[model samples]
Target: MTLLSDQMPCRYVPILAIRPAEMKALEELPEVDKDSMLPLILIRPWLSANTLSKSINRFKEAYGETRPWLADIDPFYAAALANDDDDDDEADPKKVFSEIEALQDPANGYSNWCAFIEADPRAIPCLRLDPNNINALTQEIITFSAMQRGICLRIPRAGFGGIGQIADILNAQNVTSVLFILDFEQATMNELSNAAAAIGLINTIKGKIPGAEIAISATTFPDSFNGLKEQAIAERGFFSLIKAQLGQFRLIYSDRGSARAEKRTGGGGLPPPRVDYPSFKNWYFFKPEKIPTYQAAAKAAMTHKSWEPKMKIWGTQMIERTAKGDPYAIVSPVRSTATRINLHLHHQLYFDDPPLALQEIEDDWVD
Candidate 1:
């Protein structure tokens, strides 16, 4: 696929903690976090305006590449550091370059830590205790928050506190529905604890925002998950993790090709890994080879002792079923609130079924 397609990098889906609707809204805003945007600009020096072209050109001439970070000077810093002279002219690109150069130059003893201090000295051990520094840092954060209005919310993998921060913002924004995607490629206790806590926070806020729904989509690996077997094992782990934490689905929709999002390309640098997933198209979302695994996982997740009559319809069906095949089933959680998170684990394959063709299967089918 293309290095960067029109599609949002798939890797970010789980990071943003957004739902389908919110994801659509984000596509309109096309929010890019400062962290992600900065790196992209830094690596692709040509993205910078012509004013800084000279500095970029010079850097390219010297280092055989344009310094992407130097391309578009941070408007925040440019305005912060601008001269107050009555004559209004663009900030001197050369001076701007020099400051950034100084900030980056290790020869000047400006290590990353020093840059951090320079950017927000309040974070320093000594300064952190100072009220003035704290005030300044708070203001900086607030200002940064305002700047993020149009950007996608970039959720950090930091523990509970970080997740809490995300919760507060989403709640304030009246974002009720969320999809938390867990990338367990590199699992750890701390990470797991933080994730669980994050879910708890989401649950806590559900009372404030009525109709709030949160679902988790997790991927995991087993001792041996290579080639064809990989799909089944991954789904097993995905279901098991969610089941271990939350429990069974309230209702489930099992179709092979429904949610097999496009594979992602690893991120180039600091931003979360870039992904290349398919957009909303009528066609199957997953690959054709993985149908059996998806069916197996769905069967496992939706298994009930006996087909309860209530298991039939969870909510308004999103798609309609036809004689050709069953429509994808809708999966529901035991509880609607965040307290009982729902997990949708299935094999990764593209097994397209007719709209709303889901049939009630015996519990033994899943067992």
Candidate 2:
């Protein structure tokens, strides 16, 4: 049954990693169980560490007191929990054996947990017919491990006095997932201090969120395009060097671009003078030619199911040409199996201004 309307905007970005807990949460919803079902059980093939970590947290919170049986919650969680309680960081041989034995016990009910597992995230399931798993990241794939204990990290705009706090949150014994929002508002291109700060922040957070991937969202860059570019290059370098990192990176620009005084065409019956230098381009808005390399770099920061990687770049759709007939810095995704599927689904959903058949979601999971 389609509990969520196809017409409804998905609360989360479907392209990014979906946590098993998020999926499990859907199954446990009141709508799914008319008969007061105990914890819902799902049987599936593969569960990514990202999915398992988030699922554990979701169930941990949603089923507080009335803890439902998450047969499929990460097998390691029980051990991790037990280990967290131990004062010494070193593993005790007997303690390890006890946890393993407890899990093996039928009374403990930690075996063959079920959640409807269809697609394997690791397999980089092809979206449709494109034959390439282009949408999957090639680097650290963000998962729930970054936000263990349901902790969320919001870096402050002020001097990062909160770095200690962020470390505290990331170091939480139960922390397995994190929603790391890198606030670059204070970033100034004139000085590398902000850039240095960002590098420091990322280095500190690395590998702190265990098992699951981290979700990175950057607010904005500097005032000048050069500053933005400098910061972007620096950040790209930092993540490239780090072996352990998050699953996804989202760049949300505060403004599209600062207005520029390109000489007006036909102003007072005068043609604009041709300029040698092209207009400025920033990370947020840039030439389409840059999309492939930029997206590739962004995806590089993520871990993917396949080495042959693809990515989806979303921004303002450009169709019209300006009076000068010069094209705007229009950005778009490259062709791939995933892109085809996205286009097919988009056409189906918004083919009409107000779609006629939105009441029922067409299963676009298949081509």
Candidate 3:
């Protein structure tokens, strides 16, 4: 079986939150998009332990194949699960460390966490470098490295100082095939500073490991769309800057797939109807104030100058169906979110090399 590490050089790496909307979006992706990227899924704590035990099957069903992908648990969510806390407050850091350590324990035999790595032999385990949990994280690296398949070490932008320690760990374990993810969650590009920092970090990693595959990721996607009609995808610009300095194939481009980097803590009542349309540079958001219904929003998106009538992706089709007064399409906020994400994924895949003849077809009627 070919390991996910061996399948290097994928175009994009989207860090997706594991939810119905996100999963549905992934399930509906075209074959070309599926083949072009390797998604790193973060398992949230919405499901019961029983359901989570069958997660690998769920992933296979959504993906339509046993293709290799990366898997990691949301630390805060896992910590809450470990302590059986029902509130939305952040769990204790010690509990989070313990929970992560427990997941790596082989003495307990098979566990739901183990299912993430064991059920699908192709699933690459993701390890976060935490100073509070350094020992546990190190042991996790060793254990996952023992699997012979490469492991992904996720280093947040702030954690760059620990790259030397990570290099030592890899060297001590004699693990060569590794994917280093420089995660800059919620951070946006500000001129060339962020890009320069990232370039320096990439250089440091290369100097340390010399053979480490690297991916730079972040999200400028806002947590709330209120008072915002458009937003620039700073991560894209950041990737462009780094690619210009280091060459195109030096690192992978990654993002949060148009979702917020930090998960919302509490449920805010239902969001106003909105449709986020991705263009080459920005996300043009449509939210009608006079009539705040999904159908109205979909109609606005359909009539917008940026709407691509020739684009046959599932998300666009959903918008078209909803605009035509199809009650079954985009009935609720969750479905709307799914539709947006589905479109976003397709957009990212074709961002650099757009399909020929994909120009917008003129509509017969005016909005």
Candidate-wise lDDT, in order: 0.27, 0.27, 0.73
Ranking by lDDT: 3, 2, 1
| lDDT by residue (tens digit), candidate 1, 182-231 | 22323322344333553464455444544433333333222221232112
- Alpha-carbon deviation at 303 in model 1, angstroms: 29
Off by over 4 Å in 2: 1-151, 169-173, 192-196, 206-319, 324-367
- State the lDDT of candidate 2 residue by residue for 92-148, as single tens digits: 434433433333333212121101112121111110111122122111112223211
Candidate 3 runs further than 4 Å off: 46-49, 79-101, 104-116, 128-139, 188-193, 356-367
Q: lDDT of model 1 at residue 76?
A: 27
Worst 10 residues of 2 by lDDT: 122-131
Provide TM-scores for the models: 0.27, 0.27, 0.84
Error of 1 at 104 (Å): 13
Global fold similarity of model 2 (TM-score): 0.27
Q: Please, what's the RMSD in Å of model 2?
A: 21.7
Judge candidate 3 at residue 181 and give its lDDT: 84
